[model samples]
Target: MLATCLAQGTSGSPTVRVMSRDTQALLDTGSVVTLLRPVLAGGKAGEPMEVACVHGGTRTYDTCHVVIRTPHGVFTAQAGIVPNLPVPLLIGRDCPIFRPNKVWHVDGYDKLKPFGIAISGCIDGYSRRLMWLSSDSTNNNPAVIARYYLQCVSNCGVVPARLRTDCGTENGDMAAIQCSLREDHTDEFAGPLSHMYGTSTANQRIESWWSIFRKQRTQFWMDLFSDLRDRHYFNGTHEHKCLVWYVLLGIFQKELDEHRELWNNHTIRPVRQSLCPSGKPETMYHLPHRFGGRDCGFQVDPQVLQEFKDLLPPTNSLCGDDNLQYFANLERQSQLAPPINWPAAVDNYLTLKEMAGL
Candidate 1:
């Protein structure tokens, strides 16, 4: 058997040519029950056909059209027709994927306006699905991010094989959770390569999803009610602080929930030169194991979680004047007041009185 390296133009890709078509095939990565082409579709009888195949140049192939035969049922399938030689079935960074509890991306955005709504999000790197999205008075709390991580694993029935974060201090809480998963712990997150620490630019998948929510109503909604350009809304008028606050919070939560639905179902944008069929993240997330994809058997440790909960910062701290709400009485706006520490107020009053000798 002989082979020759076909030289490509400066802008063209190089190619390899074999002396004959009856060469032995080998797949070293894993066992191969059967040698098969990936592009053949089922529901049709197998047939040998010659088709024009163009890559660097046009050629013809006497390839057979047959579906993949797996021990199980036809596991999955995909086919595409391209105008030119299929887009270089290649591109920028390949989409990061791993079975659940294998990989996750963690980041928070603080782009909310004067009201300062902040949120933290986590995405399954493999499935490209949003694992967790949580908003609170603050996004900088390590404990809060950790709680969201715990909640995601608890509800989703999976843990990350690896975790990715933008190196923000708040994400450090994950380290404690990792530490809690000691040598004696189960295999839920036993992998040592648990976190992929990267920058905002490097963590593209989760960051791009943030734009989905931001585009919906980051500045647009806040500007609608708050005196965005005028004096500070917190001090300008009482209405700015209370009137539309709960309304803002209420509506945004609903929008975020709806946005998550739209996002989970949206077609994943293909990476630069990928030829794989675009898919919904939700499908990969929920049905991974059904189609030969692996699943990380992640189980949340209750005692470990309870121990971590004690280390988190208090989430009930009042950060702004507009932290208003409506509970049993939906029209209880009148009862809402900026969190006022009366002790500090009394001390300031007494000091002022002494200074004025009144």
Candidate 2:
């Protein structure tokens, strides 16, 4: 088995390391690596052994842990811990305590106890929900897509004077989004939605979003959710469900629907009273969706993304303290609006929309 690829051996597989006595602390220096016969000899002499084999004109390793048990004591001589099991073996290392074969019942089954049984299911109920929302929804509700998009926005940290979204009906209007310079500073968030790229492009962002989502949240959930199985970083956490609704809303124009709470108490920056009489009217501060660009009212031709290189500065050239701050704030915001009972949230939206008669 070790000679073929069907099983791996510490002798050479990249994933497995074969250690020497110095490394293992189990075997001694100059101690030979060998294999003991699995079956005992007819008399009290016990099993004969030889280290590693060159048989049929081929050098091969063993898959079993065959070792000698002398009257002095039994030691791991060869067949290092099922070598083909892909375990590392340090040569000359002192072998660990050994499990010896005892008297056995004629029936064979009379001895060992049964191993426990286990079960599993789709553990990441939340990630599964997000995947469902992203793949199923046509609205691209900012609420549903909130988790993924906001994470990126938070991660990127550039609160642009303008923002862009694919022309999906979901990002229809950046209802909740708003941006403005810290002061009458040079940068006014300005950028246009990429109307040319369709849902295919949307899916790409979705995939990337899943990658990050899994990285941040899955391991924690797996540690807690299932002892028998593992949870994926993306498909396994409840936060994924909560995050989906937020991303959905952000993608949809529904962001404006939620921003009301943020503005009532959200402090974007310190009031530069010297700059404005009323210490900077809170209403004046706006995000990209609130003003400017093709999504809001400006005429941005769809061709610009192809020539985006000419439109915006390179990342290193453009990034500065503010970009970092913006990213930090975005991450904070994700914490703020983690996923809620989304079905209820949607039902509330429908109820409100019906009341509004639009």
Candidate 3:
């Protein structure tokens, strides 16, 4: 059949046109079409309908709306009928999802602060021992705890995310947990509220609120107590006083200086140097001498000379003149050569007093 290219300006580009209405009718609706015209509510003639059609290649007819496979019921749609055209698209789950009704809102507390806190560090300090804090029903050890925190922090960054405590008991009672989950399931919070599973990204917004909470805690509780303790005015009820002070400090003033520094120097700064396409610049900084920092010079353990030799590249350990010369230069400069027996040499050259034997 012959066709004409119609330039539809609104939709853009060239639109093809067929020769006759009979061809358009055949393309729009096939034979054995079901009558969905009456089934659709508020649908009128000439309205666009969603026709679920199958062609003869897949089915018996050249193109038919009758669905062959139906587990629960038969599915059919009439030809040339418009589908449900809700003005605004509904943006929510269509299915009745079971969400355990458990909504848990977790806020961290760092014992000595007025503000809630969050930390990406292993709940238990991993460097000291591999122990983790056990708030969940799962078994926890130092390694597990450290790994858990490191994994969480590494995935979410050093900035703490909203922590989740499972609260599942060994008794197999999920009611209390479910209740807690539902109560905290607000629009701002997610948990059993929608089909969307819980993720760390959702808690990122609340990270900004941490500094404010920290400031309140620091000023009223820890800082005050720390100052008092340093001044030696701390009495028996110092802890109690700090707690009372925190409670009394009703107005909280956020620490803007540190937050501003972090934003300007770290958070918003652009990185220019990179080792590879994806390698990241070091984020954590430590004092060079006072604390452990990057070592510029190569250091080798004297006891591991054999292992070091094993680790050396073949070219580095080669018997060639160039390699030998390079190693000799390095040994002379670094003063790190093969072990020498200083005791035998020293024994021959006795001190004046020893030689005199007085």
Candidate 4:
């Protein structure tokens, strides 16, 4: 039976024969050239080609054309033959098969966990200025994210040359608004091309800034939350989570705003490798010409901006209406003052949790 299954290929066929279930392929973004096993190439004759390996070594190998089939479609590309390749094939960035499809999965543990606060932000790619960093109940809502973008445009009175963001469904409204704002502009980056969507990793400007943000601010809150969980002061219950958000969201937002202000005013030292202006972010953003940079912001029409704003749904409360009202009532009955700091917030969270019998 095994011999008959292996012998089902044409005698002079140039295509490789392999069981679909047994075949393995790797999609590598770091590699510049695709690779295939010589055995999988069906004994095709090829010219010598020099190929670089991930181990920082180079080897001359024969080249061949590889055909890959997937559920979506089929792709053919030139590949260097790697005789001892662990996988049957390796598709690299040089091939058309490198297109990315992102999927989000939720685990059972994650479902039981409390939903944390969501943050939305944007930055000037040229001056490296912090545009807006805001916290909300949910950033996944398109209206909430769009509101942030629109608010930024309204305050600045201009739209950026291009609005780049990750390919998340939450960004759909913002992308539409950006393209619409630049529709009539004569600039090269206009209309539908005004918005660019790619993976979060590719958006280095904001991605790198998040590291600084976590170290300086969010880390403390994360530690505090972990401490709460460990101490049995806060479980991942819905009511407990809502209480936490109600008590701490305002304080968190206040601290975030303060940090944003300080970051914009702080002087950044010159780096030889960086092309961005090195002075205060606020100055670089406002007066780009002084730093040999151009302000690529496009003027936004007030009427059009308002029209887009009107289409957005009203922002919902972080905790639902019943929870918000119940928590508010509990605070009123207990005569507890609103928390103004982390310590006070923690106290309020515990006190409310006990009152709600959670």
TM-score on alpha carbons, each prediction: 0.56, 0.18, 0.20, 0.69
Q: Output the worst ten-in-a-row residue range by lDDT, candidate 1.
A: 1-10
Candidate 1: misplaced stretches above 4 Å? 1-97, 182-192, 217-219, 222-227, 230-247, 269-277, 310-313, 320-358
User: Which sequence of candidate numbers ranks them by TM-score, best first?
Assistant: 4, 1, 3, 2
Estimate every model's Cα lDDT from 0 to 1: 0.46, 0.26, 0.24, 0.64
Please rank every candidate by lDDT, starting with the best.
4, 1, 2, 3
lDDT of 3 by residue, 222-297 (tens): 5654654565444424232322222222221123233333432333222121011111111211122222223211
Highest lDDT model number: 4
Clashing pairs in 4: none
Candidate 4 lDDT over residue span 205-294, tens digit each: 465567677788877777888888888887777777788778888998899899989998999886421233468878877876677545
Q: How close to the true structure is residue 14 of candidate 4, measured as C-alpha lDDT?
A: 22
Better structure of 2 and 4 per TM-score: 4
TM-score of 4: 0.69
